[model samples]
Target chain A: MEIIELINVKREFKILNRREGIAGGIKDLFSRDYRYLSAVDDISLKIKKGEIVGYLGPNGAGKSTTIKMMTGILEPTSGKVLVNGKEPYRNRIENAQDIGVVFGQRSQLWWSLPLKESFKVLKEIYQVSDKDYKDMLDLYMSLIDIKNLWDKPVRQMSLGQRTLSDILAAFLHNPSVVYLDEPTIGLDVSMKSKIQEFIKGLNSQKATTIILTTHDMGDVDALCNRIVIIDKGKKLYDDNIENLHKMFGMYRIMKICFSKDVGELDYDSLKDKAAELEKELQENFSGDDMTVSVDEGWIDILMNEEDVSLMEVMNFIQSKQHIYNIKLEEISTEKVIKKIYEGGTIL
Target chain B: MKKRNVKFYLAIYFKIISQDIKSKLSYRVDFIISTMGILFTNIAGFITFWIIFKNFDNINDWNYYEILFLYGFSLMALTPTQCLFDNNWNLRDYVYSGDFIKYCFRPIDLYFYYISEIFDLKGIGEFMMGVGIIVYAWINLKYSVTILGILALIVMWIAASLVMAGIMNIAAATCFWMNNSGYVMVTVFKFTEYTKYPIDIFNKGFRIFFSFIIPIAFVTYYPSMVVLNSHNLPILTIIAPIFSVLFFYISYRIWMFGASRYNGTGT
Candidate 1:
């Protein structure tokens, strides 16, 4: 069943046009100017129960705005936002009862209180049953070693610890839907994997529907079954990860390090050499399915594996210059997203 | 979220407040210093009153003790908002830092959650000082206390507190549009200084403005008049309770409107 649905939702903001310098500042007081910006522009979405969807977007691409509208912190400029079949903004309190939200840049936990105290307050606020609260504590304690953090004030806890506690608090009420905006941001790799494991465990145990907005592709790969990519307030692609891979995964990266030290050349000379090599390769290949660039003394080539094999590209480069090292890489979600941002076709 | 009753809300409020106090008390030195600071500041104001009244017989026929009664009444009226609603001062920071979104995420009233997040314990010192001054002034004036009169005073005190809190809510709500309403809140709150004196000292126009327009006069001056039984318009005392309730309701509506217009800071 659909637990969260957004229909043509849009949010516009009126930003003041602050002028430059002291003189311009003085002039602004007399005649104020504002420009309207559509942060979320007519985006439609449907999220089902127990679905973990990665809401992916580049910076300033309205990912956070869409999450805000879903969480009822923002009322869309037009169109509908329904959570559990109720308009979220109009019925925020009721909607809030059924959902939880965590913004990575902003903490929801009480800064001065301990993790356990904050949990107790949340328990009262959500009216969690005593049995449910105890079960939640037991579940969390069994999954993770969090006893040491129970009495530590949130201000004293490290970033990863605080984030872990925040996630725990968010799921404590067992809300049917949860929104995690950049929850894994700034954590170390091990902590990131641990959090991912915890999230997976909770998802399987409770079947909680999760909408995760993030820049980290690792999180997307580990937690999300479906991915929705957006750009500049427009929906670019929304599909299961496998389908996305099948469509964009044919591309491969070839990194070739030449025995000649390209670092000895100036940046301009290096750019000129890269451009010359790219032109020669394009003329030889006679196809637009490949891109070549120079990075840190290595000539990196990204091309569709179907159009040209890795062995062909490596052999051509090796014949021209003595090869020091060579590496091949399959396309990842990260590279695919970069390609999409570079205006690649969705299909 | 559900159809919660008043008792449920009150219980949750105490729960949150107790946790807030526990966190605040953790910083022992800071807590003591702030409480002492508030106590000293109020004592300094009382000393100024003492120095002024020592030279003059009275200001506009109001004696020193009478003025003390009014001052004490004003402080008592201000205490509830100071202790319970002091978190309104942090609204600007919350909005600017994008922390206000946390309040919206909770399954509770936004205003209730915001206010419950902090309880300024220093207001306890202010309350004790206010009560001490009121008792001292009452003894000096030899005012007889009756059960009915005490009940009336309690009602007026609650009304006065609502008036102060309503004004504060209106000032804080401007943060939604302005992004920072510190100056507005401070300037509006400074007007509370007028409540510590008799409205008769001001000109007729200023007196009318304070009583009707800004309503600070209703907070302490008019209420004190009713207590002292020297009120020319006893009807104002009756209207004070209703006016305070309506004033708070309107202010809450303004806050809700501002909250709806809240465009959170950039991600």
Candidate 2:
């Protein structure tokens, strides 16, 4: 059974307009100027119990807006969100018990207070059993390695440390689902990895369903098996993250290096080599993200980054004449997003 | 949440308050300076009154000490309000920063989490200064240590303080929408000055407005009227604490309502 469900979840916001000047300001006090904005436009998706799904989108693409609706922060304009068979907005206080959300920019733990104080407050708010509270704390301490920082004030902690505390505070109630929106934003690389590990730990150990919304591709790569991309309030793609690489990011970059400066290649000869390669592929190879350049003691060849794996690229380049150190790398997720942003379709 | 006992809630609040007190004391200069500053505010109020009384002869038949009682009573009535509900000062910041999200996702009532966790020891200074002035005024009023009068004062003052705290929080909770925040307690202290005077000075219309429309009288006027024993204490005075409890529930409801609407923007 699905632990979470959303049927045509939608959200509209009233955009207020103001004419500049004192007169307009006074008039605004008497009457508000507003236009309707459909932030989340008729979105519907479902996650079965214990699934970790990535909610991906560009900035202002209604990603957070959708999460807010599902988490009961914002009520949908035209649809329903059900978590554990309860309407998120109508039964918010009850719905809150079932899910933990850590908004990356907001500190869930009290800033002035120590980390433990915020955890204590959560205990009262959740009414968690004593045994359960201790067990969860123990698990978080292992996951994030923040035992020493427990008594330290939140204001004094580093971004990574604070995020660790926020994550702990969110999950202290042993909630069935966790909603982490950009949970690792602004953290150092080490901290980001730590947060990702802790989240995956919770998902596997507790069978906790997770809806992660983030722009960090590393976070998505590390934690999310399923990716849902939205642009302009519409779902563009929802598929396996690995499959995304196969469908749109299968290209690899192969660079060949020569031991010594290959004496100036004849421009005519290089153009001829390019023409010959184009003909060899019978129109399969094109210079889109592919090009060869000659510089400082080496001739570099860049080609169609495809099914030719990095290992294959290296083996193929190694077998070629006069090649020195050869390098092959898979395209990172950032480039994949660039392709998607430019309206590239994935199979 | 419904089944959770209030005692459990109180225990958590007390724990947070104790933690706050210990943390506050760590900054000793701040602790001493704030207490001194709060005391100075009342001292300023007294000097202002002395200056005015010298000029006016009397304010509607009330003397120096009489006015002092009004001022002291108002100050004391407002002390707990500031001490308890002053934490609501962060309501606007809370909303903008989406800290209320932290409060709402908890299994317990979010309302208790905000009001209970933070304390102002400086208000303790404010509360003590009022106690000092009230003692001086009581002696000047020719009120001996009459057990009945003191007991009535204590009982009425408790109800009055709670009511003031309620009004302060509910007003502050308006930040859920306005988010344009000012000092939660001091900014709207209409009664803190007027509470010392006898309700008689205000016209009947204003008296009704203060008594019910805004309930400012619950803070000082009605309670002092009891201690002075000027007239039979109305049954309505006894009902003030009931209103205090009601205000608390209503304030919590408003706070929780605001808590739900908060969208933590930064995620």
Candidate 3:
């Protein structure tokens, strides 16, 4: 069954478009000029139980707005939002009881209270049974690696520790569904992986439906099997992770360390070589889909695997110059998002 | 299962308050200083009133002790309201900082969650000082204590606290419509200063405005008149509960209206 559903949900906010400065500010008090901004425009989605779905979007792309509606924090301007078979905004308390949400930028825990006290308070607030609470705590302790940090005041804990505790608190009630908005944001490598592992555990072990919103593609790669990408308040792509990789993850990066310094090469000489390489690759590979640059003592090459094979590019590079070492890496999400932002679409 | 038991909510509220107190008391020196500051300020205010009455026998027909009754009753009402609902006074800060979202998704009522977690320990000093002043004034007046009078005072005090809390809620709710409501709250709190004196001292326009429009008079003046066995209008005290309930309902309605507009903007 779908634990969360939004049918044509649209949220419009009336933002006062006031001018700047003292006189403008005074005039704004009586201006009555409001520009309507659609934070979420006709977004319809259904998230199933136990499915870890990544909700991806750029800044101000209505990602948090949709999460707010799902969490019953904001009522939709039009259409319906249902969580567990009830209108979330109308049945807010009931919806809240069955779901947990973590805003990575905000701490819901009491600022001065110990982490354990926050867990205790949330346990009562969600009315989790004693046995369930104890069992969940044990599981969380084993999974998240924050057991020793439990008694420390939340204000004293590091950002990563606080975020881990928040994740624990959100899952304490064994909620049927959870929304984690950038839970791994600003976390170190090890901490980020730990959180991702914990989120995976929650989904696999308890079958808790998880909706994750993050810019960290590592998070999407690690935990989410399906992803929904939105930009400018509209859905751009919604597909399985494997399919996303297969379609848009076509670029491959190659770095070659020369036997000698290449940085001493004149700009004109490098530019001429780059243009010649581009002409050869375009003629040989059937398209101009590669870029070459010299950095330090190494030459870096970025190529679309679809346009030119890695072996072909390597052979060409070897023929042109003496190679010391070579390494190839898949294009990063940073590159993919930049590509998408530049109007690239899944083929 | 949809609706939580009121007892469950009450238990959580107490736990929240106890946790707040525990956190507050951790800064022992700061807590002591804050409490002492409130006590000394109230004491200085009491001395000022005492000196004014020492130079003059009475202001109009009200004696020094009688006016003290009004002063003490106002503090008595104001302290508890401030203690339990102190966060309401800083609602604009909450909204501006986007911390108000913390209250929105809870399984408990948002207003209940907000009011329960905030307990101002400084108000304890005001409460103690007010009780002491009321005891001292009663002793000097030789006022006879009766069960009926005690009941009336208790009921009136609760009603007065409700009125203040409701007014604060209304003021806070304005943050939903406009940002930076510090001015609105300051203005409203300044209006409450007039409740410290007998309404009879004010002109007819001010008295009528206090009685009908803002109704600050009911919070202390009219309620204290009944408790002190003096009545400019006993019917005002008799109808205080009705006004209190009416104001509370209106404020609550206004809060709900404003809360629906809370978009967690700038979050």
Candidate 4:
């Protein structure tokens, strides 16, 4: 079942054009000049039930706007937005009952109250049954160690703890669809993994459909099976991680560390040596698509694995220098996304 | 959407208010000091009235005790909104900071949820002071009260509170379009001062402006006249309650319109 759908949805904001100087400010009072900026432009999507989808985008790419429309906090300017078969903006209260939202920069929890107090207020607001509330609490407690943080005031808790508590509060009512915007932002590795595990556990246990908007690729890797990428108010790519990798996964990075330090060479001499090495490698592998550069004491090679195998590059580098260590890395999702943003791949 | 009964909202209101009070009381000294500050400020106003009454025989045929009664009644009427709807004053900040989106994300009525987030404990001090002045004036005037009179007073008080709340909500809703509605709210709230005195003392223009345009005169001036039996127009007293309800209904509609136009700040 499709739990969320958007057909050619668009949103535009009227931005005031403020002139310079005091005299210009006075003129602004008399004249209303505005420029319309489209935030979400003619995007269509369908999200199925029990699926965790990563909504990824660059800055100002309309990711937040799309999430806002889905959560019922914003209305699309031109098209239809439906969550659970109801227009979210028109049936906001009903839609809100089944949807939960978490904004990393903005918190919905009561700052001065203890964590549990905020949860109790949410319990009353959502009208969660006592049995259901208790059962949810038990399930969460078993999955994570949050019992100690329950009595701490939200103001005193760290950012990660507060975000954790917020996620718990949002899911306390067992909302069928949850939207997490940058849930892992600014969190340390351990906290991030803990939250990822908790989200994974809840999603499996309840079969809740989750729409996660995040800049962190680790979050996408750990929690999402399908990913949607958007840029500049337009959808660029939408597919599973495996498909995305298969399309752009041929690139690889090979780092070869020299046994001798290259710091003895001057900056100009270092550039000269890197150029010489690049020319030599290109001459040797003429038809291969590759780029070579030299760091402090390491020679780095980025090449398409399909054109030139890792063994060929390693053998060539080994013959040129007394190698101390060699490291091979697959293309990271971050790099693939950066490449997509740079318009290197055709969608 | 499922239609929820009033009982559900009432239960949620009490829960939210109780939590608000609990958090407020955590800072015990701040609560005590602010409450005392409000009490002192109201007492200072009463003292100003006392000084004026000492010099004049009567202001517009109303004696000192009657004016005091009117002042107390105004304060009492203002207290309900003052206690509950204080969050309206921060609507500008909430909208600018994008915090208002949280209310829209909730399953409850936006206005009810917004107001329930805070319960001004300092208004308790204002309530006590108003009641104290009313009791003192009642004893001096030798006013014999009956059950019907008490019921009428309650109705008038509730109607007056609705007028104040309606005005405040309307003013605060302007923040959706403007950069800030703080100045607008303060200017409109200043009109309530005219209710503390006899509306007859004002010129025809001011009287009509307050009565018809803003309807602030109905908040306390005209309602108190009915209670004191000194009203020249009996019809004004009867329509005051109905007019207040109509004003509040219109204000609620305006609020809904403003809310629909709300485009939140950038993330």
Candidate 5:
């Protein structure tokens, strides 16, 4: 069931060391000086069939490079890369038949061709049987409803329409594995959700494995069951989404509503009181990250659930003030990713 | 290894061409102007040739009509190569923009997909002009036409086109390492202009260079020499087909090497 495997892969790119100015340009033409950049360094991963894996990383973190190697567009400089038990770059044409890829920034569709023409061309390239092609079209049309845009040239279509069409083309042949790099990038919220839904639909119907690379955390939350976080060409975290939440996703915001009205509480005195309460709470929950700020009638507290339980946090708050209401909010995945980038270790 | 079905590749090629033409024709004025511009350029080139040959009796024992035949043959060979595989000439852009990545994901042969994906229809005017000049030169020279002669001409034309394609492929492959090789293609294409005249007029070094190093002479000059019954080595001209096959294979190997490097390094 393991459809894709990358074993200790490393890819290095030679950077021509060029200086500025016309004279330098001339000298560079004759210069043999160059430096090598390791883009994907010593990474190993295995992706199983029908599993949606979120290949999450910041820019320049080697997400696309790994996808390229998996899709056979790139060969690792060292180690082994196998898709469906065949070395991808060594058997590219054979590997390509079972894989599909879409770069959100680049369209695989012909610029001047009608959407349908691109589909037909792909049909020939993959040798998709007519019945299967028709069935795919029917299924995709029902999911994304691109039938009306069939005759329109890809150039004239909006970004959402074009990306939708691209996704359809990628899955047209029922590829066993699909690599989607930022497929929802540059689309409106509604369009992004629609694409996410379509992708989910395809995976369920065909049991297709998907490796989605995206900056959108919502996409990762919605689609990916497992997440692989890479930073600077190294795998920092690889676990299911719930575990990521348990590890780095424990920050919570506590908003306390005081029984007293705004006029009754002196702003300066309340601010002083809130600062004193924060210092006391910090000592008790020593390793937990916490902060408190007071408004006219209420105090807002932010702390990590890993160090202090919700009951403990509320007990401290209730001892300080008579609360009329309380609001507890878990940290967003976006903030969790931000914290990961800031060097938060996996639990 | 399972080979791709030829019909499937042909279908992709025709589809790409049709789409390319549609894209070009969408801008009606631009397409017309570009086609007309090429036609005018060819006409002007012929006029310059007429002016030069008017005063000279012959250049290195070849008359004006014979030179016309040479130029016409070069055009016939060059146009098809440039037209069918025009996108290969834009490999610099493809590399810079990373559009080449799309070609890599396909099941088809990379070089085959690269060449077949774009059809420059502006070459139609160039082809028509070439045919007109060739017929005029043939009539004026009164070269006797036989079935074998016609067959030989067709084969020579095919070989010449292959030579041009091979050269273009090599130049495009350089972009894999160089990142920008438009100048390489332009320089090689300009060098082919030397084949439109008698090699004897050029210096001994130039002749040797064109004959062996770059082999532009084999494209039209040598083939024309055999066709005109002026071959110094008549038997050698028969090697054009063999030379073309070798050239194409070597160029393909070079392209594969470059592609592997590209994938390995991603530059």
Candidate 6:
């Protein structure tokens, strides 16, 4: 059975032009103008149980509007949203019981309380039994490496600590479906990896159906099997990860760092190497001085972000470089998301 | 179906409370400072009256003890509500950040979770001061000492406070749409301030509005009126409980409605 199903869901909002400033204050008092904005326009999607889907879009792409409708937090102006074969908005309680959500930029934990306290409170809300609670807690604490930090106040804890606590709060109930919005935003490399590991563990181990909307492409690369792309209140594409990469035509960004200090590589030198690497991989890579540079004894490489085959570029770089470690990464999920949004043809 | 009733909700409420307390205690200094800050505020209010009464005999025939009694009842009547709903003030922040998703996702009512998070231990100071004032006023009023009256006062006072808290819950819940209409809460609170004292001092219509429509009268005025045995306002004791239940249900529904209308863009 499908864990989530949305058929032609649409959301429209009324625009209020009454600006905040006092300059047009007198004219605004009597006149009330309403404009229509289709925040989520005729979007349809479906996901089966335990599939980790990367719901991607640039800012203001109606990705959030769609999620809000599916969660029953916002009523769709038209169309049906079904999770576990029930209308989410009409039957909120039942829908809610099966879902867990995490907003990356916000802390769900009480700022004044310890991490454990938030967990205990959630325990009662979800009404988990002793055994289930212990099992879920053990699993999360292990994956997230949450130790004594649980005892510390959430406010006093670092950004990493608060995020871990927030993640734990979302999954304590062992819900069947989970929604994560920018779960890795504003996180360091280590913290991002830890969160990704926990999410991956949940999806693989428990077969938890997951929907993640993020600007971070690494999150998609590390965990998701499918990607749903939306832009300007519309769904442009929805399919497997391979399909999104194929349709969007994204490329790897190879950044190589030298062990010893070296002279700056001018735009010509950098472009020459980039083109050479491009031909070697048989993929088109083009950039100017601004896109590619060498500064502070480190080599920075920006390839055609549209190309997906990083392994080819990896082999090419290995054959060429004497020895500094090289880091090759794709353009951010947000950037590929931007290309998909702007109606740019995939290269 | 019957198994999932009030007991189910009460259990969840207490669990959330325990969790909130645990979270609050994590930052030892923040907790102590916030709790202590309430006393300073109360002292400021106390000192204003002290200076004013020091010069004049009384304000419009009310002495310090009488005024103190009013303050005590109000503070006490307001304390429990604040403890329970202080987090309601955060509803605006919650609305913007869409953090209220935590409550909506739970099978239990979001009302309890949102209100419970409104924990503000600052009320402890108000609670203690209120108790002291009530005692002083009771002694000074010098009515015949009876155990039953004291018991009734405590019981009815709690009922009144719950009603007050329920109203705040509704105002706080409105944050779902106004996203920042949280300012409305402060406006409502400021509006409540006018009714905190005896409305009898005001004109006929204003007093009528506070007593009947808004029901700020029941919070301190009615219970104290019962204790003092003043006027012919009949059987308010019975109406108190009925009103509490009615308001709690209405405000709760309004919250659900607002939440439904919530975009949860931060969701």
- List the global CA lDDT of all models: 0.85, 0.74, 0.82, 0.85, 0.82, 0.73
DockQ of each: 0.55, 0.36, 0.53, 0.46, 0.39, 0.50
Model 5, stretches more than 4 Å misplaced?
A11-38, A254-302, A305-328, A344-347, B5-7, B19-27, B230-236, B264-267
**lDDT measured at residue A182 in model 2 versus the true structure, 0 to 100:** 83
TM-score of each: 0.91, 0.83, 0.89, 0.88, 0.86, 0.81
Candidate number with greatest TM-score: 1
Give lDDT: candidate 6, residue B237. 51
Over B1-267, each residue of candidate 3 has an lDDT whose tens digit, in order, gives 535778888888788889879888998999999999998998898889889988999998888888888898999989877799888877888788877887787788778877776788899889888888888888888888888878888888988988888888898899988876889988988898888999889999999999888889888987787767544547888899888989988998898778777777633
Candidate 1: clashing pairs of residues: none
Chain B TM-scores across candidates = 0.94, 0.88, 0.94, 0.95, 0.91, 0.87
DockQ of 1: 0.55
Q: What would the DockQ be for model 2? A: 0.36
Clashes of each: 0, 7, 0, 0, 0, 13
TM-score of chain B of 2: 0.88
Runs with alpha carbons beyond 4 Å of true place in candidate 3: A16-35, A256-301, A307-325, A344-347, B230-233
Q: Summarize candidate 5's per-residue lDDT along A1-347 as a digit string, tens digits.
A: 79888899998788889999999999998999999988898999998999999998788888878888887777788989988899887888888899888878678888788988888888888888899999998888777777678998888999999898888889999999998888888999999999899999999999999999888998999999998998778888888988877765567878787754656777787788789978888888864468787755677787777777879878876887678888877766766776687663643
On DockQ, who's better, 4 or 5?
Answer: 4
Query: TM-score order of candidates, best first?
Result: 1, 3, 4, 5, 2, 6
Write the number of the candidate with greater lDDT, choosing between 1 and 2: 1
Candidate 5 C-alpha lDDT tens digits along B1-267: 235777767767887887778778888998899999999988898899899999997988898889999899888888987699788777778777766777788888888876776778999888888878888998899988778777888888888888878887887788888855779888998988787887778999998898777888877877776567643656547788889889978988998788776642231
lDDT of 3 at A180: 91
Specify the poorest-scoring 10-residue window by lDDT in model 3 chain A: A338-347
RMSD of 6: 5.6
Q: Quote the positional error of residue A292 for candidate 4 in Å.
A: 9.7
Give a tens-digit lDDT track for model 2, residues A1-347.
88888888778888678778999888887777688888887777888888889888788888878877777767888988888888887866678888898878777666667788867866876788899998987777666678778789888888778877888877888888898888889988887887788889988888888889888889988998898888777777788877887764556645455444445555566556545533543343444554444434334444445533445444544555556556656656755675676663533
Model with the higher lDDT, candidate 3 or 4: 4
Off by over 4 Å in 4: A14-35, A255-326, A344-346, B230-234
